[model samples]
Target chain A: MKIENIKKEFPIFNNKVQNNDLVYLDSANSSQKPLVVVDRIYDFYTKEFSNVGRSVHYLAVAATNLYENTRSAVQKYINAKHKNEIVFTKGATEAINLVANTFGQKYLKEGDEILLTELEHHSNYVPWHYLRKNKGIKINFAEIDEHGDISLEDIEKQITNRTKIIAITHLSNVTGAILPIKEITELAHSKGIPVLVDGCQSAPHMKMNMQDLDCDFYAISCHKMYGPTGLGVLYAKKKWLDDLPPYQGGGGMINEVKKDDISFGELPNKFEAGTMATAQVIAFNESINFLNKIGVENLVKHENDLLNYGEELLRKNNSVKLIGNPRKKGAVLSFTIDGIHPHDIATILDEDGVAIRAGHHCCQILHDKLGLTASARASLGVYNSKDDLDKLNESINNCKKIFNK
Target chain B: MNLKELYQEIILDHGKNPRNLGKFDNFNKDAKGHNPLCGDKVHLFLKLDENKKVNDISFEGEGCAISMASASIMTDLMKGKSEKDAKEIIEKFLDMIKEKDDIDTKLLEEDEKTKLMSLGGVKNYPMRVKCATLSWHALSSALEDFQKEVTTE
Candidate 1:
């Protein structure tokens, strides 16, 4: 499990992307999966496939146990107090929508405000925006500082009597700013407000503890964690899960149904309706195990070193203006070239087999605030090395040469 | 497949200093175009004379080299053409970008055909075809006075 040899685990690296080795820096969008996680999906379908929580057949029982085992693994991985607090959805967007719909249905009233930061991805903001339209709830934003970090003071300043919930990103996908989630949660709790953290960018790269951070709801994207697509995890406190109304109704999430009256199932099942992403849910356990084997601290250290190296290298390159420069940052390096648009930069970079994300990265509000239409982002992951970033720098230089910068 | 074909000297020159890259007062028709994927945008303004021929054309926005150059070249070629001729040229250019092997230069002169043919490189880059066609789409929408903004989703 040497960190340097981590790239060998991902089969993508074994092949060439357009006749060049893949310098994947788009992990913040979605991570490249390891062999174990990919194999788990194949093995589950080939050998041990069954619809979970359904029939009493032998394969069904085994599949049920394996599915629930991943739930327990997720519980322990995020250190949630209760296993039932973890609910699986299609993706992080669905997880946030579930919370917003259920919470808005039960608690949010007219004129109630949900405080979000400028760095929130559209997934985090759009779901709450539904409440603004339907329930007449107001959404407020905490502005980012010059360095693009959202401070506890900024969160506190936006809090008022009408503010009901505080939703924020754990780490900005654009700026790489890691917010003070624990302190923000503590502040919200002091004001008797709940906090929802969009951990799509944070959960894969950093350590997370539900009880430690004390956020009421945390949404995670499994694909971004080197797991399969079409699966996400929502970690909420037991009380919130217990109190919130069911998001969607179907066969699996029902306790009793009659012609006139129906009672929903309990905790995790209440949130998860119909046939879930069975193979993806089961395979995600390998993703958790993969992270555990390499260890979060090591991944954090490796990514931090890569980020610093990338920052220094890109900083030295003239006309490559790095965005944010937050005191506490993640593994994303978002920048813009002076004479070239980000799309042009990405196109040229792709010519060299370097995969980076360009455009708003789903943070249009932040981009507008920064007076930019788009930017090029090179995000890192566990498998990324300094060599990959070196390629990014070289490709950026090639882009400058092509753009006549 | 060929970056050189996509980033030709003419294309780079137009992208660097785009032609008609500003708003014009007293324009009769205007339309905005947006590429949501890349966040590139273009606002095309045009004035048609009594004979329905394009008297002036201008654009204001920012985008990639392909998009800016496409808009720049499009505006330069669109001026002085009838609305029907402009529509036909847009269709021909868009057809070339999508699937057509070559544009019908019968509607265009030799230099106009050459300038528009430079963008034929976009056909090799599937993701960027929209960038090369966005301004053309906006111009078409402006001709019809489409109420909603045109978006290359």
Candidate 2:
């Protein structure tokens, strides 16, 4: 499929938003779903609705196969060695919380450190903070450089003998800086420490290979991947999943339940407690197929072009300070106008049907480091185009005009 | 829903050069307000005299034009008012923003009423109503000697 035609695949663009075409630039927050993914959800609920991994009924068996098919697709898509390594959670927040809860239960101890970066979203940091409060674990941050990039050296410098695990973002949602995960994992492994990569910002934009990256644990947000809300994928090595205790205990995660004793199920089921997001899991197969049809390489090329164009255009505009001049950046463009607050800028931009995110973007630490209270971010997905960015620039100019800057 | 109404010139003026935009030296009462949604913050300081009159009032923080302007105008109008009257004005202002009813502006001068009315644009924008009300809530908390930090959740 042609990259320009990608917008046509998303049904949201077919309708007008407040009498204007939607110039969606908040994909890093959550991507707009394509028609295939949306229709798949409808078709599943309308025709073949049933709970998975539960019953012997016809719809139950069919739903079970469809649900597991998505698991296989995700396993192949990320190139994980084993399909059972993929466990679904509510969202990336839950996935990270699952790891923190299970890992803290078994390995982490008082005074043990978990190395993080300044660019981590609240989802990645807050889970580990719970360990700090409950398990008395200390958390250290690897500082970002002047360009907002966290280098391998930063990670190595923060590693201590007490450092048990290093959790980091593969791609920063705010600065668009892609961390050196493969190298970070290699370094962490040399010290006998595990690493968890928050792939919420990375999974949807780039190709991911769990085996190649060699990170012990990685969490992905399905909603950001244009799949659906209420679904997340946690890819852990088989060894860790087996060794770690079960996160939550309930139905479907049990092997044998007695009044006196209880045993747990195996692999993914051990982590997925209660009824799963059956329809969302089944529908997400179409999201993977949609990406496969267009191809990640083509999508990357198209987005890089848009990012570069946006960077150059905003750079030439006076009083607009673009954040993070990383050597390698993604399609995220975060900036602050000199005289206008980000909320004002966002409010003005919304009048033009330009949907961008303003504020900390859930990275309060990074915002403090950058000396900014808030920022305006224009992030791109496969469907974004240069025309959309042009409207964004125009709307920014209007915002400046309103502020009389 | 109109952007021009929300971003009126008076709001921009107040937001740019906010009045009493600093901490008080000997504030008898103070409280912090935070809007976690957008990371907007306001720290309100009050110096109430022995007669229960507001000898001085000030604030320090960062926010959007609507919020900063609201705080600036609020502090400016709150000076010299009794604590009871100040609380009443806050209640009236919050009521107006929530579109409950027209507040009794008899206690306020015509100029002060005009300045307060400039913030009425927030009534049209639901998401921004918190921005306009955050500092007022903080002021109320300060007057009542509430210990917890006020949050526009």
Candidate 3:
């Protein structure tokens, strides 16, 4: 694929933001949808819409197949062993909550600890906190190093006999630190602790194989994958799917509904209760196709190039101070400018049609550790290039000039 | 909508070197305000005398230029004003940022009104309206003696 012309695949890039070409560098928050994904959504809603897995009608059966096709596509993409391991949820936040609720009910007890890292987004940490509040479980944090990276030793240091499970982010959203999931999972398994990898950041930028990582559970955000919003994929080991109770009680999740007793359905359906985002699930097949066309390896190289260029440019600017210097980083450039707040930087950047995210980026614990209330982040996606970084650098200079720094 | 108007010289000056900063030792009424969306925080301290007039007002917080300047300018104008006058001014300022195009000129002096109106540019940026008004709301909560922390969700 011609990576330079990839922005043409997204309709959003065709228009101007504030009379200037949109320099969208906020993909760490949510990626812009490609033309293929958007078209799939429209096509499904207009010509081939139906409630899936409900009726034996031709449209219903076809819709059901399309929905399940996404499951198999996700299974194949992530290399999960079983197709049934992929369960759909509202988003990654709901996916993590499902595990915390079901696993907390089945496994956790009073005084049990759920070890998380300081780099986790609220989606990874807040769900476990619910268990801490209700189940009397303790939550321990694996501290980040000076470079904002969490090592295997950091996870090992927090583990105890009472540690029930270890949940960590595959990539830090704030510091862009990529965790060694395969190694961390191996160490957790040695101590009989299950590891849950929050792959919201990693899934869009790297190659993921369930067997290679060996993590018990992985949560994916579809919106960040150039897929439709209101859809997420939860990849769990089938053993846990069978052992844990259903997350929600509603239609399509139960094998037989009875007044006194009920039997839940099998595998993914048991966890996916009620009517799902049928159109989103169907459209997400296009997202997988989009990623497959370019290939994740190509995407990684392109984004890494942008990251390196943006990092070098920002580092050369004396007023700009980057948050972390992790040895292994992703496509995120988070920084603070001297004599300027992040909000001001964001406003000034937006004036030049440079769209970046400001504030803690939903990683408050990490921000607290960095001793900053907020910082500005310019994260990249497949469509971004060095030109966008140049715009960002120019905007930073404008912000510094405005503040007389 | 214009960046130049939104970030005027006065706003930047106050943001860089905020006036009436730091907690007051004799503060009697105080309240902390938080903008959970952006993580901006303001702790306002007020010392109302026996006549219910603001003898001294100060604040300490971390926020964007708009917020810090808003708080700094607010504290500068609030000193020596009656509690009733402080509440009225806060209401007017918030009204201007939220919906009203201009703040009532009678509420403040010409220089003070211009400083407060400098923040009026925030009205165009809907996402940042909270940044400009977070401290003013904190002052309102302090005057009312609200026990809970004020939040701009």
The number of the candidate with the highest DockQ is: 1
Q: Could you give candidate 2's per-residue lDDT for residues A9-105 as a string of tens digits?
A: 9999999987889999999999999999999999999999998888999999999999999999999999999999999999999999999999999
lDDT of each: 0.92, 0.92, 0.90
Model 3 C-alpha lDDT per residue in residues A239-278, reported as the tens digit of each score = 9999999999999999987789999998888998899999
Better of 1 and 2 by lDDT: 1
Docking class for model 2 is medium
Could you give the DockQ of candidate 2? Answer: 0.60
Give the C-alpha lDDT of model 3: 0.90
**What residue runs in model 3 are displaced by over 4 Å at the alpha carbon?**
B23-28, B47-51, B109-111
Candidates sorted by DockQ, descending order? 1, 3, 2
Residue B33 shift from truth in candidate 1, angstroms: 2.7
Give TM per candidate: 0.96, 0.94, 0.96
